[model samples]
Target chain A: MNISSHRRTRDRVVTVLTYAAMVFVLLLPFALFVGLAVKSDLLFREHSLGDLLFSSVWRPSSGEFGFKPFIVGSVYVTLLAMLISCPICLLSAIHITQYAPTRVAKVVTTAIDILAGIPSVVYGVWGMVGVVPFVGKIAGWCGIQSNGYSILAGGIVLSIMVVPFILNILMEIYRTIPRELTEVSLSLGATRWETIRDVLNRKALPGILAAFGFGFARAFGETMAVLMVVGNVVKIPEGLFDPGYPLPALIANSFGELGSIPEIESALMFAALILLVVVLIFNATLRWLIIKAERY
Target chain B: MESNMNQGKEGRNIERPFAEGESIIRVDGLNLHAGKTHILKNINVEIPKNKLTVILGPSGCGKTTLLKCMNRLTDLTPDIKVSGNIYIGEQPVFGSKTDIVALRRKMGLLSQRPFPLPMNIYNNIAYGLKLRGKYTRAELNELVEYYLRQVNLWDEVKDRLRSPAVRLSIGQQQRLCLARGLAVNPDIILADEPTSALDPVSSEAIEKQFAALSKDYTLVMVTHVLRQARRIADYVIFMYLGEVIEMRPAQEFFDDPREEQTKKYLAGAFN
Candidate 1:
């Protein structure tokens, strides 16, 4: 047997093995999710799919299950978190790339990287201990008497945890701008501030929007930190101070008790399916936006 | 302080071209250092007003650095130390109280490669005028058209002023950059090999525009091409190894040729 043919056979075996492994890893979770959802739907066919998706009655004892409140809670907290994190991340990125001294920028970049690596449970503990009381005080000043655990607290905690992720991405995008472009603007009698506002920001708009999408998707799916802070009341919040339960929080809190009520388990599986669908949509949109940015 | 440094030069006859028609830019005893590498050493010359002056040198010999220094664009580079007395018109460029924005407004620069603002064709030209002061929509429109016309880009792009400037060809983008620079109405135009990236026809178009523009503005260009220097330069400064080796009228410098390095460079020995 020739050595070349022996090596070729070995290479073919390795390539086939890698492809099989990749396909298995990609499909395992999706198969499990669909199988569990179908099983739950067949086992408990009392509540219709609409009732499981849109109705807010979530009492498991009387056999009523709905996920509307969790869906709304997830959207509200995520949007508020995005609203808080986007400007802070963008401005900090701009300052680091354009205004701050090199040494200071390096220090800030290191601090942000450290923040990105911190565990979610640590953020939850910090939010429970530190930010919850601060939010309660601010709410009290606004003449709304409330406990500290609320949607605002949860959103604030989520924003703090995810800021470094968005900041690092945006800073990397801003740094890709060519030095010649800025110099050309400045040489045209533009002040430094004008150059940044008119030239740098305009050029990086699409990438900035993409960063926002990434932050939103991450915030929407966050589980542990939000679960600790948000009072899991399972209702649509009327104000920032009102307590609410998001989908991920509900799933995390109720999964251990699934054996008691089969219908609750089915409903929770459906919620997970919803989350999967929403995340898929977000990722698709993000990919399309990045391609659009590069095209022009 | 300025004259004393030049007078101490041991044996070189530094050509004083300051006797020509009203000198617009004068550099005396300019020395530039980039992190211990002496980039430009004791440079002295006068660029006359309303004439095309070419700073002729090979690559890395400090011609581009000198052009950038005139507008303080070298301040963008890190660890650069510049010591010199440079005057544009009557204003001191390196003085402590100089307003760099206003100083830059008096000069227009065309780089080697074209980079139009990441905007539409109309906005690229309108942005600079808007930064200067308020202008009515009609006034700005007329001004944009006038400037584009001056660069001969109006006929090609007049129909698609709102389209993104990056959609244009490389040659058109270069011309748009020229229009954008001229929209600010600068007194002097500094070009760092504006035609180096261009095809022959596009390069000829730019050279023709520069010749016409020299009647109204002081034009200073840097080029390593001996043919380009001879074709367009009214006054020429020949530099080699970070020092000015010769400064003379273009006709005399090309025909009679004073320095040995300039002669070798002109004979196509090596860049």
Candidate 2:
């Protein structure tokens, strides 16, 4: 074959392969979800989507299924985790970029990157052993009646796990801000903190929001660390100290036990759907915020 | 080398070699080093109050560095050490007791390219005013308009004061930066090649503004363009290779140069 013909064939093959891979990667989870939902619907033909979604009970052995408690658990745990992590990550990012000396910043960033590289299971074990007791003590001091394994413990562990992710992204965003902009503010007699508040924060607001989106998504869908500490109880948690079951934790904890129970299996699939939808909605909102900021 | 002709022309030209005025900024034996490299050497010059003093030199000649030193802007650079006595009025600028922020507030700086704060046109001007003190809504609006008018930007930006400053043309942005600097009520305006990023027409506009502004505020401008120096300078400081080579009046510096380096630079022998 001539050179041009060979090149054309090679390009066509690569393009076809790439498109196939893209479609498979994008649709695999969706296809699985549809299959699971249909199978569950057929098995439990009597139950409506409302009963599967809005009902509270989720017993598997006798074939009861409801996902509301898991949904609430996911929302509350993720919200608490984000509340704990966002400010700490943001302030640490600022401190690294603005206040810390070069050596100190480098050391802090290296430690954060190492923390980010650790496996999620390792985080789970660490939380199970270390954070549970500490949180129990804090709860005792606060006059809450509980052991360490609760929503608060889950949130505390999740916040610690997601902090490095958010901090790294935020630090990168802050670093990309042109040095000239800050210099101009400082030259105008603005203090370091004022420069950060007025100039750097304003410039990086959209990116910071995106970082929060990533942190929230990770915290929401996290399974291993949350499963270890969250006291996997399928109930609407009354307070931070109450034991709860997030969607991922519920799915993981029930998948093995629900082998003979079709209705509970379908309920688990619905829980997965909720998690997927929540992530999609959050990412979409973040994209909209960034676009709005760029428009101005 | 001193020009012998200066003696003859001293009586003829009232503003002979250097314009006479109260010296607002006096740099006494300023020397600066960044790491091991000497950035500025034995710089001594008095910037006359209410006059346009242009520091003219090619790139790497320390002209811009010298301009920054007067306002203590060089302190921001790491691994840099400076030994000098810079006095703004009676206050020593480099004294350990000096408040750097307050010192910087007394001087407004315009860089080679304009960097308007990431805000709307109105906020760009109002930022400095708001920093200094509190002002009600009507007062802020009035002052923002006042500075905008001072830079000949009021009419163009009047309708779009709420829009982002980055949307303006480069020339307009430069003028807006000038207005922002002026709004702070600084005693001196320090510019480092402020017009090099601008087109000829915009450069002319900024030069015109500087000419007008010199009657009230002491202006220190740095430029590599010899023609611009001749055009806008009331007093001239010619630096070469980290040293001040010639300090003279604008006309006198062009008409007759004392140092061979200044003569060569003026003749465009080398940039």
Candidate 3:
């Protein structure tokens, strides 16, 4: 066949086979995560894995399994990170997009581009070496734990890490706004703030909200940075400042100590399953919001 | 056509060749610079009160630029210098410490694209009046209803005021934009290629609406379409290459265009 005709001709068998194989490849890890979590046979080798998932006491010796604490810690950190990051990220994005003089906008965008490129591990190390002491001092003053390794400290670090993500996503969203809308609003005698509040923000708010969900997803899945600052206590955190072990920390801690108890290993896998579900849900929601945002 | 209705009252100036006699806005020696390149050159014209004046031009002819200058919208761009006396009514527009908001209150402009604020239909129309605080809930409701009805969109949208203006069809959105502009009670309305994106039906509807609006508000429009210029213009200003080639009564303009380029343009020999 001629090259033009060949390009147009669809081979139904190849197309179907190709799509099925592609789906299988994509589904490989998805299937694995679910398989490892729900497999009752994996429970035979060491019931500790299944026990820690369901028991109130998560210790392997007593065969107590309870995943509620790690789930709670992840929720706390993610929520705290969102609380700290959302407005700051949006304001920064707005400033860069609308208020900054052209030169200032250029510089701010460049800075954020560089900030977003910084590795999450480096941010984690910074939280450990620099942020920990500062947080300790502040927490002590507030009659909270003197340890820097608290859910609050980790959450703040996660916020710092996710702010760039929020700002970058929202900046792109802001750029998509037609110049006509802003010019019309400003021409109508709306002040800078009014134009942004009534015209600009309302226009971009959907994408900004989607960015918040993405930031939460990133914060929820964060392991190393949260691990460094969070005290890794399995108990439920009493306040923002209290120490807690998130799912990633639980997974990380149990990985090295897996030799000590086989049930702990099972529980770690169970925790992995939970973290996987949470991040997936967050990602799905974020994607839905972004799609909805584009429709508007 | 309804344009003829509005035209009969305002087009003639006691046998003075039908210049914009009431002179709602006077432009004298206006020089607009875009990065040191003069875009509007030594311009002089008068736009009449409560009449439709259409500015016809080839592309890059500075008609849209001139429309924006009336409200100082051009000032928002950096490196664009304007040296001109643009007087709106009795006030010197370019140099007044005029409440930019209050100044914007007196005039409204529609862009080529219909940029209804990323807001509901009601809020889009309510935006301007709310800014200037002319809105009692009853007044705002009355005004929105009045303007929407005036734009011939009230019946279609009265049920969906909370729906985002973006959801409207392009023609409906343009009319919604017109209603938004009128909601604040502006004396002058400038439309820049307002129907360029719509089908013939929409363009005709907008033309009819502009004719009706001219009874109460001064209307200025910039268009590249000669047929549109013929249909709605009371006074036609023809611009070619950033200069006003001719300003004449609309009938005289279409009947015997003064400039060769204007003749060529009306004859459809390239923009």
Among the numbered candidates, top lDDT falls to: 1
| Winning candidate number (TM-score) | 2
**Model 3 agreement with the true structure over B1-271: per-residue lDDT tens digits:** 1233122222431211354448787776678998868899867777888889999988899999989888888766767887756778767777756666677778888889799887789888888878868558999898889889989999999999988788999999999988888877789998999999998999899999999889999999999888888888899988887877888889998998878988888888434
**Candidate 1 global CA lDDT score:** 0.86
What would the per-residue lDDT of candidate 2 be over residues B198-221, giving only the tens digit for each residue? Answer: 999999999999999999999999
- Tens digits of per-residue lDDT for model 1, A185-248: 9889998888988898888878887888889889999999999998889788899999999999
For candidate 2 chain A, the 10 contiguous residues with the lowest summed lDDT are A35-44
Please state the error at residue A201 of candidate 2 in Å. Answer: 0.9
Between which residue pairs do clashes occur in model 2? Answer: B17-B249
lDDT of 1 by residue, B33-130 (tens): 99889999888777889999999988999999999999988877767898866778778778789999999988988999888898899999999899
Model 2: lDDT of residue A35: 72
Ranked by lDDT, top first? 1, 2, 3
Superposed on the true chain A, the predicted chain A of model 1 yields a TM-score of 0.89
Of candidate 1 chain A, the 10-residue stretch with the lowest lDDT total is A36-45
Off by over 4 Å in 1: A1-50, A283-296, B1-15, B18-21, B267-271
Using lDDT as the yardstick, the better of models 1 and 2 is 1
Calculate DockQ per candidate and list them: 0.56, 0.51, 0.53
